[model samples]
Target: MPLRPVAALAAACTLALLGPSAAAAVALTPLPQSVRESEGSLALPGRFAIAWTGCREPMLERAAERFQRDLGRLTGVETFAAAGPRLEIACAAADPGALSLEAREAYRLQVTGEGVKLDADGPIGVLRGLATLRQLIETGPDGAAALPAVAIDDRPRFAWRGVTIDTARHFMSIETLRRQIDAMEQVKLNVLHLHLSDNEAFRVESRRYPRLHEVAGHGQFYTQAQIRDLIAYAADRGVRVVPEFDVPGHARAMTLAYPELASNPAGAPAAGAQVLNPASEAAYRFVTRLFDEMAGLFPDAYFHIGGDEVGDDAWAGDPQVEALMKTEGLTTKAQVEAHFHRRIHQALTRRGKIVVGWEEIIDTGTLPRDIVVQAWRTSNATARATALGHRTIVSAGYYLDLLNTAQFHYGFDPLDTSAAGMSPADADAARKLHPLVGRFVTDGVVVQPMAPLTPEQEALVLGGEAPIWAELVTDEMLDNRLWPRAAALAERFWSPREVRDTGDMYARLAVQQDRLRRLGLQDQAARARMASRLAPGASEPLLVLLDLVGPVRNMAHDKRVPAAIAGKKIVQNLTAMADAAPVDSLAARAFLARAERAASGEAAARAAVRADFEVWNANHRRVVAIAQDHPAVREALPISADIAEMAAVGLLALDALETGKPLAPETAARAKVVLDRADAFEAASARPIFSFFGKRPPADLIIMVTPGVRRLVEAAGG
Candidate 1:
């Protein structure tokens, strides 16, 4: 019943060559460091064979199987494992030893008419090459599988390209975690930082303390076996799984199960007492044992003991903690926090694991140089940590949970800014005053040029991560929230600094988006399903509205809806058009540009603009009818009507522009009134359900026709 690999390869090659323009180059994501295109191409069959020379590692063999399965899934071809020269995989040397950071992940992939070859230093490099090969496979002009002839030498620019997923806020299933890991591997992200515990829940099962899972986790937690499985899954794809157990603060879940470990006992109303009892010996013992068990599950040497946001009141009202602080001669709450971090650092050190924590730990001034600080709150944290002789990872601008556009995250570079302009006297004085002084320069013309990081400081900057905090995220929204954008972040972490063209990045992203969907990412599909739920009788209007609008950015959703309502379900308060769309305003702007060109005498562009406006104009009636029977549709009816009115007014302005007639004073005034009304409608619709909360800010609405209509009206003196 087994299909021969040679036959599959031959069939794929024959089909690919039959298509026209089979040698066209495919735009690769995370563009290679160096690539040279040739004049031929290799046609891939539905079932292809891989020929290995000196690649015997089990990881490499597993990678080959993955590649075979992925290719079959992508091309609708049934691939088989066999030995042949159709696709040759090999190592550069005879002894391609163990994989590590020191081992080169750089790979050279060469494709020709005869076949394709992938060469790497180790199994890790081979996996990287395979990912590239998967991305390179494209359907030719005649719809057959093909790969353009090219030679690509590629390696990551940073070693710690990562994504931190917070499961504590929202317990994600193991299957979901695996899917995310698969997605991360597609973009070649190297690390998966699992935030395993927080105030809401302790997401990992503790066999040593079974109550931690049964009571603290609310019956939703990953078993130790699941954790190990996830680690192996990540390892096979060249990703390190790092576990984080937040301590001192964000410890309500832990304290719920073991009240004795809490600084303030159950039923006690003490200020700033919602943290682990640093003064309690039992607390330290519990943490040490739990961390040891969790660390043993993850093979990676790095462990994250969350040391962020330990409030000033944390130990203020606790008698025991106050006594301990007094005994230790600690004057400020920060000093107490420092003491707790130092103890944990010492414990982790004894276990032979490197500790990684948030920026608060760096402020402690007690953590050893070996600890890694993750800078999330400020731009200069990475530079500050590195300046102090500690390695650092930047995550401030890379918080994907903020819902910013991909371009915003891509523009943030970990190594771009430094403390080079300050004088030696000022620098030293500033260091004494604050840790971030040398990391960020003040905004203004300076007497001296800004200095780049010293070679040593640069060396200490390990890399960066995109942290996806799951406060408002749900299982269904995870794929849409992470991908396409994470791919962009991946490029930022992998490609050379000079690769900063946002336009080019988006073009490749369009292709990658479809590829991700084909690979089982439900970003687009989820939106469609949500739209159907909103307007089952007529979902097109809802879909059209979403296509032009996106979710408000900068945590605006948090402001517009109550936390209790939003937190209960992902789609509870997400019926607005923007909730299902991405935040990039580029597409609307592009359409406006076309509309402007249409005004300059392009008939087809003019027709296109008119057709789109007509659709929006007609959508209002359909939405109104649907809302009559559908409560969900009614919820978004106000914005829907406003969009329709904007489109109708846009059509009027377009007519005047095409007629080359100046608008009368009265007509112009009426046009302005219509525009103002549309704006007011948008503002009113965005108000929170609880109006007593205060005056709501105007919604971050992206009306596609606004620019085009404004241009037409201004030309007509309206």
Candidate 2:
């Protein structure tokens, strides 16, 4: 089906459609492709029942139970099989158990004064329709729940709307994984790409090769029974779990467990030995057996063999690799990788798997055309692969662990082909908006212009994923890191290419986060717990500070921070200001809105912006008092001072703008110095050198409102 303007269906919608008795109108994420709302509401049945008209299928029946429970929870009314009002679900043609890229997920939901009728071609479609139905619910003036009168026709824009859950770095509980899976289904996300094994650890228990988990897991890994349950859970929610077991490199933990598989002759589980000896027959036997066994556990056809970061340190002068290179006519590092990947690819494909690897898989030679390459580092990853008839998943700009805000990631369209989502002018505007912060989220990208592909090659792009690498994240804060932002990216994958309204996306995103929380995700609760832990008797002030500040962006919060600064390897300290701050600063966003309006010469907006600065200017003293008293969180003191000083600077700049005068050069210089220091701190954090890394890094957080301050001072034209 040719795609329509994704949000255009609701482009003409108005609050009038709610018949003047609705609580805010319906705002759905991954907005349906088609919508027509009218002036009426369907009061939810006080007594509800689900009328499943589909074939006798367990998936549909289970979905009905879930919906009925949601109904009672939402409406405060009990529902039973014998009911007064019915939610009629009709899917006569659905293959209830089928879930894949080819599965039919299109559904039409019509909610009128009479009742709700959900029609779909299959069970997956019914689930999707049910999700939309849940979103359409609103509170009536009578204080009762109601469904706004509307009709929606919806289907995901991409077959692979995915999220990557990294359990290898920090083992997430099965409960945590299931919570994300539930949230995924609620937003129409269809794939859960599990980063199961990495250099840090192997997260999945291995019964066949006991040592892989026993020795390497360090007492934490999911058992096979748990994996099976997870797979079944994800399947019921229409999510496919694709497991990634990195090979050739990112193999420190793997080699540590099986010394015989190490690339280094001495079997040292160090940096240089962080790769399996691909030339060794033992390596091949281990890989073939382990992968084939894993293939049986994960029923999905796609399996990710992490073929990324195959560093020269691991292969440069290794004797086994060199001898194999000479004998196999592999002249370079890339060629040697090709030999290993080709063998691994053949091994998995023979066991009925479509081998998925990182963008570096291209180094593995021509190999089989059926291999799926995950485009992580660059757009060229997709461009080069699609040209060779290999399928690709674009993940270049969706690294959620970068601490980028939602709109920044949403801008990177997998199919835009030109500029990824922003033009030169847009990018310039974005960077200037937060010049003081130095590394505005958009600064680090070097956009690659994709060579135009034929229609056939374009189809090879199977959507994208938002990867939440667990380096700086763990089960405690994973929800806060991935959510709401992932919801925005989910729309990019599920909604149309034309749905580019960042403002609208943010508005709906707020609603989606609240909905997900109510549905049992703990992002906000976790953040609150960490904040309370930081300032025992004074969490309110710390919470406010967190809402205003953001965690350091990109790889700024990596292992080197502790290794060089704190003299440790990677520490999961949850009470620090860095851990408490969320990547998206709600206060910063609100302040920026008013600042934007004030910059555009609005009067009331100027007052509101000034008020925000005033609050921040005073709020810091409380936070400082709380932080200094707690040694574990004393790192927040400098950041607390900066927030107050910056807020004062903002007030000064606003006064100059209001009085129609230039800021004094001295004041502007001071503001610039502070902003420059903040930017420098972010830059230094991401580098790997001692001078930059160990230089008593200025606070662990980034000021999210630096852009407004910079804009005002620059606007004062000092």
Candidate 3:
């Protein structure tokens, strides 16, 4: 927020004014707090430029430079210093302080031909304005660049809008992480929670405990200098980087590096080897020193000490741990973990930091009120944590690796008491699955009811985060694993609670993805890259297949990770169909929308629906050929043939509709049998075709288009 203006750019590249684009309603993501548009548009030319006034904060300059680059890249305008129509940025009232908890993010903008003004309370607010402004750029008539004539007043709904990236398992390069930060900044999201350590590896370099980096990291970790550079990079963009150092539990990597730090250094770490030596005084001292060093690197006030998943009998074989537990009245692992948390809390708090823990830390009720608990188990966890006066963040319904649709996560609000808008089937499944992450579940955890929080408790509830654990993701696959979906979820975090229209969110999401792609995110490109890897010159056919399939939902069900794929070479699991597929099939959703119209007797819609079936009926052969060549993708081969059969069924149903007659008894029975064979009982569920796999199989992709075909068949009276 402090003044640090950059040297203005004067690039000679042409802005390529492609004239005015088709006039359409604005489709802003996280939709603005208030939007009022009049009846005109502002035309921009190759000479279009930006000028600053009121304040020249370095953050503001950086925002301007980004705007200049993105505007040109997105619109082919090549923005630079010029004379004609320009964007005037005013920060006279901007809070001139370091970007942090107290920073003001409110902004108001007026766009018109006379002058376009971006006014904000701080540099961060200006960044939000510029982001919104970038989304507004469109090709007007004559293929010229233009912006809508509108007034927008916007501010974030939550103080913390973030995503937690797990880098310890699969190390993402600094570029990958930096790209994430850039995407976050564009969406007005303010936090980047880095899960830097886990059982698989420690991700941050440690000068104090060198082996934690050398041996524990397995030759892959962020250097101290890289961490500092990342921190500075995020700071400049008004994004804070919060570090997570799992303690007690998820400390296997650290123990492997420093044996003396394990709970049973005297014996081989067997029971509770995944955790620290809770009974050892040396463990406490080590935590204190390590946290102090970590605190110096991550300047944010909050720190995440993983206090989840410690087994109750983790100390079973160790007599020292047993004697200590008996002496300390620690009846359960939660209590033992709390004992560890208390020391970690004191250690981090001493270094001028507030401690954050997974929801499990709240179970023992021993930690102070200041701890922040990420309630991922259930929304009820938020209520429970806040009931105990502990600040909490909601993350239960926003697990990115769950492979849920953006609309699904978009509909899940942090303050909800009931599963209002959820399909009865999915809501029921969630209740059964809630708080139970299979092996990831901590012992005796409650499947909390969706209870509403009180006003006081709601005040204690912070924002939520979308966690993308890297076990099933690699550097190339991470973007598609996140983006476009994260953009919609970001809306949930930053926009008003009333902005719950899944339909509108998706429409705007398409535009937001294009902007994100222009800003260099690989979410839309990763699929193509993966497809080409699977099929050299014919990736297009695979892409057609990818559009209609998705990963099997639920981490417990994802077989492409270490749980099923064994060995550190889990990264090789990328060749699975899910690796190339999206979290959900947008193409399938669109097909269904058209099928709904076709069901209503729309001729054009029916024809379009038939064309889609034609594509599916034949696309499988190419996929089958590629899958035959790649054993990792062989699972897709059978699934591909099944789609062809379903497509043939759809064509049969369309023939019935065209003839204005129901299928003959024998024909109807045959069609029903085919559907019954491939259908996942409930046609709307993910993986509607692959229900035949053993509970968990590496070939884990769902045929999303099957449901649409089912709808068509039903409409044809089959």
Best candidate, lDDT: 2
Span of ten consecutive residues with least summed lDDT in model 1: 438-447
lDDT of all predictions: 0.71, 0.77, 0.74
* RMSD per model, one decimal: 8.3, 5.7, 6.8
Q: What is the lDDT of residue 180 in candidate 1?
A: 80
Rank by TM-score, descending?
A: 3, 2, 1
Candidate 3's C-alpha runs over 4 A off are: 1-23, 78-84, 92-98, 270-272, 322-333, 418-446, 560-572, 624-634, 652-678, 681-698
The number of the candidate with the highest TM-score is 3
Model 1 ranges off by over 4 Å: 1-25, 76-85, 93-100, 265-273, 418-452, 559-579, 583-609, 649-718
| lDDT tens per residue, model 1, 1-718 | 2222322322333333222322443656777777766676677755456788865677778878888777756665443232323888887653333323455678999888888889987777888898889888877656667777778888888888899999987778888888888877788888899998888888888889887889879889998888888888888888888889999888888887877788874348433235888888888999999888877777788999998877656676778877887899988888888889888888888888999999778776666999998877655666667878998887867888877778778887877563212344543543453333323323210123335678998888778899988876767667777877888888888887777766556656666666777777877787788778777867877777766665655455664243333454233454445566665544554465556656665666677778878888787788788778777667566566666766666677677778887776776776687666655433432321222132332244445455666676676557
Checking candidate 2 for backbone clashes, the offending pairs are: 94-122, 338-364
Better of 2 and 3 by TM-score: 3
> Which segments of model 2 are wrong by more than 4 Å?
1-23, 45-47, 72-85, 140-142, 265-272, 418-449, 559-574, 594-614, 645-697, 707-718
Per-residue CA lDDT of model 3 for 495-591, tens digit only, reads 8787766655665676677778888998667788877777677677778878887776655344434334233333256665677788766677778
lDDT of 1: 0.71
Error of 2 at 352 (Å): 1.2
Worst window of 10 by summed lDDT in candidate 3: 6-15
Cα shift from native, residue 202, model 1 (Å) = 0.5
